[model samples]
Target: MSNVTGSFQLMKSLNRSLVLNKIRSAGAVSRAAIAKETKLTPPTVTNIVNELIESNLVRESEMGTSKGGRKPVLLTINDQEFFIIGLDVGARKIRGVLTDLNAKELVADHAALYQDISADQLTERMTQMIEDLIQSAGVERTQVVGVGVGMHGIVDHEQGVARFAPTYHLKEIPIKEQLETAVKLPVFVENDAKAMALGELWFGAGRGCDNLIAVNIGVGIGAGIIFNNRLYHGHNAVAGELGHTIIDINGSPCSCGSFGCLQTVAGGDSIAERAARELASGRESLLREKIAGKDEINGEIVYECALAGDQLCIDILQETGRYLGVGMTNVINLMNPAKLIIGGGVSKAGDFILGPLQDVVSQRALTDEVKQTNISTAELQEHATVIGAVTIVLADLFTPDLLNAK
Candidate 1:
């Protein structure tokens, strides 16, 4: 096909995919509802729905009882028509999940890496794990639509590349292409925080809502923004670098070559390091004892201690939460998102962190802005990124042309 003709065809396919995706994510709905939700024309939604039904990707359900008119036929996704795989790769662990068309988690598995394996080895292990999962789920390979990967780093999603991921030692790596080639399936790669955002948008806290932000606090801090009812990647797919934002210019050095970034203070590594220091200084706390024999402690240990009412641990978490509140105040002022969801390891500090974090933000942020935005703990926790990977695959399936080669 000629270039222009191919482009037009791609757009048409993408439009159809987008419409179908909306319906699937939004659940049972009529063509009118779909059109209204997606801002597509009624005729266009009708046409897309017809095509999807014919393709066995969507089906019509019982008609809705009308208030004052004819019943509207409800459209539903064909859950058995397709399957998606989501992978979340972290420095300390790797998690994978199988989700159906509706983004429901069907099965999940996790494994820890000994901190020495190379990227190539990680890929091999992931591939093997996926195969095992597919067999265990008893799903046909042909029914598998694609795989989505949530890796920690700066990712160019449009190009399917990880530009700079210190945790994974990845640099300009074509993670999408490599995985797609090996698995013989289309693959989408995204930063872990952004994946969590998608996860919230489709299945978790931000479901059916627009204009939300999900902050992931792990070994590093990152954010995923959903704006105008879409995942916003900003100019270079690095828009939500909340972790790198300088909170103190002359304070501690950050891994991002900056000073006093949120991650440098509140990230898992930083929290653990501070806890270690406190223990070394003979400060009494449960965490101090927990890390006595271990070379290192993680955020999980800190949270556990805080939960047990250890004064030192509670104080550390509250301090971290206060810093996080400062950063979140900036985010709230800039984006004015309707919801701010917090996830990752450090969030396990639970109400200890959330209560203080919310109090500070409420006090510092603009009153009107704070009133409109709801800051809450993430329900999905660590699994948000992996589930979000599944959501991304499903989204691509519904809008294949959006990801076509240019």
Candidate 2:
């Protein structure tokens, strides 16, 4: 009799999660709609929704229009009842955002680190930044349930350790433990690119797609891979280091100590560095007049100059895109994803970069079907990683364990 009761309770919890996810996806849904979507009995849906409402996780909204009967009341997630914090720790900056359960940013703040800083200093600064973001948003500390952090490096998500960050020249830092102790909250850490991929999967371009790739092109390059509607962290949790793929065995050196890696040609820093070198060698371009000094010539300035028809900037982007296409072709041949989302600052070049990239992918990928993969700029842009950090918490909240606990 006890075993039968336990089985029934497990089924009930599963049913509740199914109904809650149905309503969450629909945004505003009627009870009948949830029942239909979840294929659960109307009474079961009613009981689950009532429990959710009583728990303040869901609320009844306006009445829905009737289909020749009494109008049904609609339900919506109580997004404002809880909050999540997202942090993006990049090589040049550390950004933090306070967001509601729906991943909408309430407030955000960032601090620049132009030079390399110690792991301790970085943690201290990040902890204070979280405090500042929470205070600026005027949210109660208890309301903030969890914090998610995304950083550039090979991160061991399970252990919450940063194995290595080539950009920061750091190794084996227990970032998650430090931040969690400092802030006194649950903390989850992930590679920035993987976080960006999760952001797209939950709320951005890859929302409806199961197989997707989010490639982030900034000072360096990295990819987040989603397979079968789940994030694929390879056996060692380093499956998506697409940037370090060797496209040329004897080309320019990369920061990762590899020769002719894809990033050396396509990354934002490489593009800007190439442009600066050209300008230093007495090559005349509109960029010369647009910038105050040689140090001012970066990826953003190069992109802006390209938009203004500067030939040098245009040529540099075209070359970078061509190299990117070579790297992406390798990705497509291996993964054959449904969507390839290009993100980070470099994607702002838009057609100037994508046009050349698409051209190369068409010529290089294995088959016509593989080449047909949809490639586009990330919809979330600068906010992808930050919002993805918030989704890390949301993902946990939606897990079966937590749902069953509730």
Per-residue lDDT of model 2, residues 1-406, tens digit only = 1232223234445667677677788889999888887788899888888877866678998758877876778999888876889999887898899999899999989999756788888889989999998899997776786788888879888778889888779889898899878887778888899899989988899988989999988888999888877777788888889889999998999888889999999998898889989999999899888886555778989988988988999999999999999999999999999999999878888888899999999988999988877998888999998898887777755643321110
- TM-score of each prediction: 0.87, 0.89
Candidate 2 Cα misplacement greater than 4 A, ranges? 1-17, 30-51, 65-73, 291-296, 399-406
Off by over 4 Å in 1: 1-12, 29-50, 60-74, 399-406
RMSD of each: 4.4, 5.3
lDDT: worst 10-residue window of model 1: 1-10
Predicted candidate 1 versus true structure: per-residue lDDT over 1-406, tens digit per residue: 2232223234446668778777766778888888998888988888878867866678998768888876778998888767789999876788999888877888788888766566677777778768877888888776777789888879898878888877756578777777766776667888899889988887799887778999998888899988877777877787888999988888798877778888888888988888888888988888767778887877788888877889988898898999999999999998998899999888877887888788888888987657446988787877899998887886666655323322
Worst 10 contiguous positions by lDDT, candidate 2 = 1-10
Task: Using lDDT, give the best candidate's number.
Answer: 2
